[model samples]
Target: MKLIFLGPPGAGKGTIASRISKDLNIPHISTGDLFRKAIKNQTELGKKVQQIIESGDLVPDALTVALVKERLNNPDVENGYILDGFPRTIKQADSLESFSKIDNVINFVISDEQVIQRLSGRRMCKNCGEGYHIENMKPQKEGICDKCGEELIIRPDDTPEAIKNRLAVYYESTAPLIDYYKEKGLLLDIDGAQEVGKVAEATSKAISK
Candidate 1:
């Protein structure tokens, strides 16, 4: 399908993409995972990425584009792949268009208030790193991990202020890609406020056409 999934954090792009990838037998390619894999493997690009990340600087777009270009060369992507987090800017989108034909860009739409509420409610287990939500997926006991009986703590980045900051950054950088793809007639909007199952169903129906 050569798809791109776009949405703010907590919009369930990753979860829905995973489901759609399995249903269609296509790989779900996330740029974040690519960076981690590259760094873990200690590739040449990985070395540069590690240095950049260690210095706490955002990775430059050129390097990011190169990494995506390299990944697209892999054979598994021959059939198709769902790109979860790439082309975060118009320049990156242009770079992608230069190398590949994207079939669709699914833009999951949710309000900032909903995003903040969803993210701020997230809790992670201290011991096993399992995830839970205060509202959506509560554990058997309050503030505890069901699997490991560990204390569940709110992630620092999941705080309301932090989520608002992230949304600001997203609006500044990635949000324009929505309009960019829409102009190209390749954008599909999906309501992200729905239940995960319903969202997945809507996404599947959107792509199936």
Candidate 2:
């Protein structure tokens, strides 16, 4: 079924979306992944996107919408697709509605404080890009990668101020979608504080019902 997964940074929406997409045999259509793939492939759209990004400007909504439409038309999407990181604004939601209505919108809820801890403590491996956290999930050695001897580094985006800014921007544009979909009775809010499996179970129940 067509679904939208919405949540703040470090909420594990991407992880849950990937798992759900596999279990339901649907394409996991994430805009972030889409952009990365397109850029890596050097497609026409990618060239345009790369130019915009190089200029330090946000990719225009129209281009993003067009790219999504192209992906949706793929043969693999015949059954449905799970949307992650799309519809960042009400305008994008409107554009999506013009194409197709969403069956369910799953929102993972967590506090701001929790979000900071989850993101800020994240450490990335210097060698293989494996990630670990100071808490919840730690490495075999402090400040060192288990698989590789390279020291782990905190990603720039993991800073508290950056995360707070991201949360503010998300709430400003995305918080409204919760109400918009709730009015249509298609919204499912789940506690993101739970384990990933538990969250996935709740999401599956919502999608099934």
Candidate 3:
């Protein structure tokens, strides 16, 4: 089933999206992953995105839309895909509606304080890049990676201010998609503060409708 997950940063949208995509056999496409690949390849779009990313500003809609369109047109997405990001603005959402039929819009609702705690505690292994949520998904040993012995460090983007800014942008830019999807009878708000497995179950139940 095609799906779009909407939520602020640290709201567990990615976690839920991954679960839904895996359990339902749908591709999980995320804009952040696309941009990271672009930056790694140092493509023209990557250079542009890297600049904006380093400046700690939102990637403009035009670039984001182009990137998203490229991803949506991929062969793997032909059957169905879980969109974890993109359509962060009215224009983009309107644009997507032109060609896409959103089966469901899963909105994960979480408080800002919880988001901060979730994000601030996040750390990743520099060697293996394995992610660990300090509290929710802790490493086997304190300040150490489970897979690699390297110490886990938080990326610069995971700062409290950046996380808060991302939430602000989500509320201002992406939250409206809630109404847009609701009008289409495709919006489902899921409580993100719950356990991951519970969240996944609730999401599946909602989308089954």
Root-mean-square deviation (CA) per prediction: 0.8, 1.0, 2.4
Top TM-score prediction, candidate number: 1
**lDDT scores for all predictions?**
0.94, 0.89, 0.86
lDDT of 1 by residue, 1-209 (tens): 89999999999999999999999988999989999999999999999999999999998888999999999999998889999888898899999999999999999999988998899999999999999999999999999899999899989899888888999999999999999999999999999999999999999999889
Per-residue lDDT over 105-159 for candidate 3, one digit per residue giving the tens place of the 0 to 100 score: 8889989998899889999999999999878888989889988699999988799
Estimate, for each residue in 152-180, the C-alpha lDDT of model 2 and write its tens digit. Answer: 99888888888888999889988898898
True-vs-predicted CA distance for residue 171, candidate 1, Å:
0.6
Ranking according to TM-score, highest score first: 1, 2, 3
lDDT of 1 at 8: 97
* Model 1: CA > 4 A from native: none
Question: How well does each candidate superpose onto the true structure, as a TM-score?
Answer: 0.98, 0.97, 0.86
Better of 2 and 3 by TM-score: 2
Which candidate comes out best when scored by lDDT?
Answer: 1
Worst 10 residues of 1 by lDDT: 155-164
